[model samples]
Target chain A: MKINNLFVWLKQKPRIAFFMCLPLILMVACLIIYPFFYSIFLATLNKAETKFVGLANFLFLFKRETFWLVVQQSIFFALVAVFFKALIGFIAAHSINELPSKGQRKWRGMLLIPWVIPPALSTLGWWWLFEPTYSALNWLLEKLSVDAIPWLSETFWARFSIILVNIWVGAPFFLIMYLAALKSIPEDLYEAASIDGANYWQKLFFITLPMMKNIISITILFSIIVTFANFDIVRVLTRGGPIDTTHLFATYAFRVGIESGDIPLGAAVSLFMFPVLAVLSFIILRNVRKRTNEV
Target chain B: MADVEIKDLHKIFDRTEAVRGIDLSIKDKEFVILVGPSGCGKSTVLRMIAGLEEVTEGDIYIGDKLVNDIPPKDRDIAMVFQSYALYPHMTVFENMSFGLRLRKFSKEDIKKRVEEAAKVLGISELLKRRPRQLSGGQRQRVAMGRAIVRNPKVFLFDEPLSNLDAKMRGQMRIEIKRVHQHLKTTTIYVTHDQVEAMTLADRVVVMKDGKIEQIGTPDEIYNFPRTGFVAGFIGSPAMNFIPGNIVKNKNGYSVFINKQISFYLDKEKEKKLEGLDGKDVLLGIRPEHINEKKSEDAIEYDVKIDLVEPLGMETMVYFTINKVQLCGRVSPENNLMSNNKATLNFNKNKFHIIDPKTDKVI
Candidate 1:
């Protein structure tokens, strides 16, 4: 009888709604919540999983020079790549917006090709172009009477190449996002601005950019997170070569934990990204919420 | 302020002709209204004049300069949009000062102009607030203040009061009229509301299907519509049109509405419609022109009231004449009942005779 009553209660509106979402809740628990806590647990364990060393792995990582280098490289890579991506994407979006409607559709579809291609496969294509000896870029340089670049050999060139490839892949995301944001602005605003005696540059500064501020901030924040945690591009292109100078947090964590067979140390290195990302997300989300409330 | 002249202006969007060769010369400091139904190219014509749209094949002159190739920023016009397109991120002061600042005005001048415009629009208290913080009516006032601060050669209003509620629309209409009187800038306003056109315009240009149906004063458009389309478009509850044939009798001419009802033409109407005898035509009379009081110069007919709408000041009586629905406006004191027979009289002087083929006044 109690079981029957429980079933009846479950059939109520709110309970039924909760039950309908039960699958998604459990899926999230297994996929996201479980792995997050499990990583923390693994970070506390010592090598071989026989002993618990509280904060030792973190302290050891902090003492290492390579860990500091990885942190600096990760922050620099994310900031520079995301900045270039956003700039180029905004310019491209404006260009596309200027085209006639039929032409805009054609250009939008063509510009999204870099994004639609799988990152790893396209990164291999970029690797071939950046190959030290038989590089296509070198051939073009020879044709132009310019010196051949040591694209993936030297440390600086390797970092530049990785950032360039990241921008090539990521700029389309910003372009698409900014295009949607641009389209959402009412056309009458531009008309009013023009009739009020605003030139092209004035309209861009006063109308387009101000209206797109919220979306731009949110897109940059999301791209920062994605670019900071990026692994596939670096792994496929540089593999943290040239004395580990281009090693980001993800690549360095993989080298330390999976490749070097020190799971606790690797987990600790990966876990270091949490505080930085959490702070960034908190600040950006607060800004977004404030803007939304104003609107 | 400067006069604007548009000569044979045409806009062809792909295959569809949005504006089919319109020519208009607006006097300096005059308020001209372009009013029509939606998709009638009234807004298109306004945009073309503002330089927001490229003129396909025409010459536009503002003052003495030809502006067909000039960009909108160089056109020296200020426009208030229907959406009140205030910059969402900027404060009201910033929104109003944006145009002046772009024109390289001094800081003190920008501040003075914005403050003055805001005071004129009665939105001085909202100067520091962002557009999102203001109500709809406040935002509309900010939009007007933005235009007022520019002090351009002409002011264009594209249905500026449409987004407001009814009461606010009525109030804003008066405010707009007052602004026009105070500034005396040559203005071109566009709207689909006939009442707005009648109330605000020194000259009302009524358009239909991308062509000007009639351009006249409000009184002329109301009393002497040149076309059937203009007659039907300009009046409230619309002027009732009944298809009929003019019959020439021994004494004079009368219109046979059907077997039951016939209306004799007055001397002036008969002189105007003499050539169209024995031809099918449309007889139009405004709802307000029909009355319950008996008169010597009115045609009396007994009509069965189908519906009665009491609107406090006046009541509308709806009935069918020759199977065509017709409405007559009567004073509320008449207290007419529905589904009952009543004697009605249509003012003979106010009746319109329209040629059926051309849809033009006979």
Candidate 2:
């Protein structure tokens, strides 16, 4: 009788569609929402977990030089890597777009190999390539009548190595996305631009770039968020080494929270990323919304 | 504006020959329309003339300059696409001025040209609005404004009015003619609509299956079509074809449609069909050429009316004679009834004799 009543209720009210989505809502709450507030609660606790410290952990991180260094490095790492990734990806996508259709499939498959491989496994291979004594790049340098240079031993080189590897792995995502955006544009726009007496660079600036602005902005925002919280490459390649100069928020939080057993301090360091990300996302999303409405 | 000459032009995509050896010449400041069915390669010919498509086996001459190897940007052509193809991000002013700015025009010159074109198109108030904010007709004007600001040597339109409603299409057709009169640019318009072809084209080039079927003025194409395809394609309610055999008569020749119907040809038509006697031919008669009232010299045939459609201006009468369905235009005052016998007069002087083997008018 209750089953019959429930079926009748489902038939009468379309609002029951909300009930059908309840399981997914509950799962998200348990997995994502619960951990989010729990991390904030953990960030406010003392070391011993007996009483709330009331921003003490955040105050402590603000006073540390290493913390400030990590902050600066994190911003620099995300900005530089994302910029190069977007640039190389855009150029590669245009090159692929210009190739004959038969040749494009082969090039696209080869370029996407780095993105398809597991990040942890690929970073390990990069780590081996940057090894101090047996690096392949250094060996090549030696054969070219140049001295063997340290790849991971020095501060600047280690930072460069990690940023280079980040670009290598992340660039394929941008390539695929930009390629899809390029394909979505109608063919007639280019033909129209050509008939308008536009050169190649003019077509790129006036037609191609303006058409791709929305996708570019959203892709950059997403890549920024992912790159800022990145931990696997730094963890596998340098492990926040070379005097901890390459430590990002994720690695620094791991170093403080898990390695040093200061969970509250680690939570506090990771929580700092949220506000920055929130502001960036809010600005980008608002711009995207405005652009969408304009169109 | 300059004249365009296409010599033995062809375009091949893989194995499919899209355009097969088309040769055409346009006089300076002439408005030519390429009209055909969907796969007839009219658009392909336009694109080749614009240098957007590579000519596989011929040369294109714009103002006596061989332009087969020239890129589209150097061809000094402007095309208004069917979709308008406006830069969605730019205001109407920017869209119109994009080409001039690309050529490194000074700011004052760019503004002058864009404003002049916009004012001519009567879109001055819409310069600040984006394309998506405008109506379809407004967007179409902006596209034309973009093309006009460059003042290119040649103007190409690829079914630009196919996207608009019937009312707007009629309105824009006059505007396009007016623009051509004012600018006097060598314009080439392509469309599949015969009405648009008739109303707008100074001369029409009819195409069929990668080849030019006929090219003539609109009046000649409507009245004296060179091929049966053009005769059938250019008219509303379409010209009807009735299979018949030309038989030699004592005095002249008569077309024997069936045992129940036959008509004698006049002196001029008989001379034209002198040697073609006893050959199978198809009679082409437009719907308007078959009338309801019988005249003194009109040949009358009895037919069973199948349907009667009242279209306010005239009524269309549908009937079948010898298993061939045909439409005839009649005055609504007749009050024709369906499923009844009615005699329709055939305007013998307006008939066409088509040789069925070659689908050509003889």
Candidate 3:
């Protein structure tokens, strides 16, 4: 009888529960769902100066000469940068994990300095190094009896510079994540594997990698999404320069919207990033769910 | 299949000597259990023998081959961990087959071996299921199955039944004994539970403070413990120790409890204490040896019953005599109750006497 009465009392407290959730519901409605639908509405319609032109902005984007070139370059940059970042990050994390606790902390702090430094400040220093004349790289090359090389002015050089900057800035995030994942594994598992006749390499392949599979998949998907939309480092270093060879979706949208003042076209270009982000997020969420199930 | 010998095995962990100069030998096909309380270094010794732990200043031999530098794999031993440590991602079949697969065994060989081990453990129907999907007892069988399939020369179990509930622990105990009987592998098990050690061990090596206190059969350890630590650690409800001096009374030598109760020494113990008259001694008695009702050859004592625990067939009566609280076993049919004044009797012939200073049997 008391249990039933308590249940009835809980049911009658809807007003209290509703008031408790009011702030949270309002925050979500105002911040997330509101802006989401608003962006879709804005993407569908043209700006003030131009009337509503359904799919015309998207068609114009496809017809543009620079769009295909920028798309190709962006794909190459994101893929190469993400691939190297994962490899180098995994290697660094493994090496750091092998060190003694104090040594690991020291090396980790030292390696993370690049990530802690402001990207704009670091890219400004990089800009000076890539200057056409009086550059430190050119000075080094001259000392080696080599001719001065064009680094940032040329299309390929700009692309390479942006990819290098992306790797430098992004690898540390993955290294930190992988290091945490490595430490989270129970030490007993390795001890057990060693007792079961596994050598160092066998332990690595069978235990370490399999244990880190979930972390690696989620981290890779996350890196791909972030690198695909990355703009700050590339914009500061290359400014989408050398015929827009370093332009990713983020910088391309910035150029079309702010630099070129083509609001409709810019919105369409930025909207192009939506499908990619959505697909990547879906993959990441699926991978996370799978990882939890594995645990 | 292997006789393991340890000579002066010492392990120092951060200035704490975990295993201090231990020397012992385990015969072939012998189920030797290293039993002790926590931090007694029994597990450390087992790991050292398995080659999983580095030996600081000793040599270990398995079947006449020096394994001081050999890896656990080269030592040809299989270990069942306390956690079971079954690969969560692998099915029971795969987990059992892993060791075989690592040795480059053929597909048919791995299948046959895994199937045979599963059959032995009665886990054949659950072979295809992952470890996380199985209950604790089933997982324990899978762990044992994993070890059995290896056909290793030596088998090591580190508190393998410590995680199970009491009933499950008893069940697994019987299962392990049955498996050991059939396989007859050279097994070394480490456990803090004396009951497991007593039931499972062919010879129990009682350890304390990183040293072997005594090594003997279960009966020897229970009937005669070399040290006070072993005496207190080896029995359920633990043997009670009453500190007093052995005085030459008119009747014979009696251990007087200072105006509370007096126990006359038996002939064998009295003979051993012939030269040590008037010396301080400790009277050790198991709970079962003390009864609430008097018998023909028992020394009577008036005890205040503080608590009564009815354990189905038998009841344990907790009481105090001479400010020392001790447990006495009584029949459940006696209807023992709490806070009741009672007269209990000690079986003086079965009592053990130890020198207080040396802690050795007098």
- Which CAPRI quality tier does the interface of model 3 achieve? medium
**TM-score, cand. 1:** 0.94
Ranking by TM-score: 2, 1, 3
Question: What fraction of the real A-B contacts shows up in model 1?
Answer: 0.92
TM-score on 0 to 1 scale for chain A of candidate 1 = 0.94
Q: Rate residue A217 of model 3 by lDDT.
A: 85
Model 2: per-residue Cα lDDT over A1-295, one tens digit each: 9999888878855558778788999999999899889989999999877789999999999999999999999999999999999999999999999998899999999999999999999999988888988898888898998988788878899999999999999999999999999998888888888877777888898889988988898899989999999999999988899889889999999999999999988999999999989988998889888977865
Tell me the tens digit of each residue's lDDT in model 3 across A167-205. Answer: 988899889989998998777667777777888898888
Better of 1 and 3 by lDDT: 1
- Could you say which candidate leads in TM-score? 2
Model 2: residue B176 alpha-carbon error in angstroms: 1.0
Clashes of each: 0, 0, 0
lDDT of 2 by residue, B1-362 (tens): 99999888888989999999898999999999999999999999998888888888888999989999899888888989999999888999999998888888999999999999988989999999999899999999999999999999999999999999999999999999999999999999999999989998889999999999999999999999989999999989899899899999787888888776687777776767867889989899999989876776577888889999999999999998768999999999888889988888988777789998888897
lDDT of each: 0.91, 0.91, 0.86
A86-116 in candidate 1: lDDT tens per residue? 9999999999988889899999998999999
Candidate 3 residue A20 Cα shift, in angstroms, is 7.0
Models 1 onward score TM values of: 0.94, 0.95, 0.91
For model 2 chain B, where is the 10-residue window of minimal lDDT? B260-269
Which prediction has more favorable lDDT, 2 or 3? 2
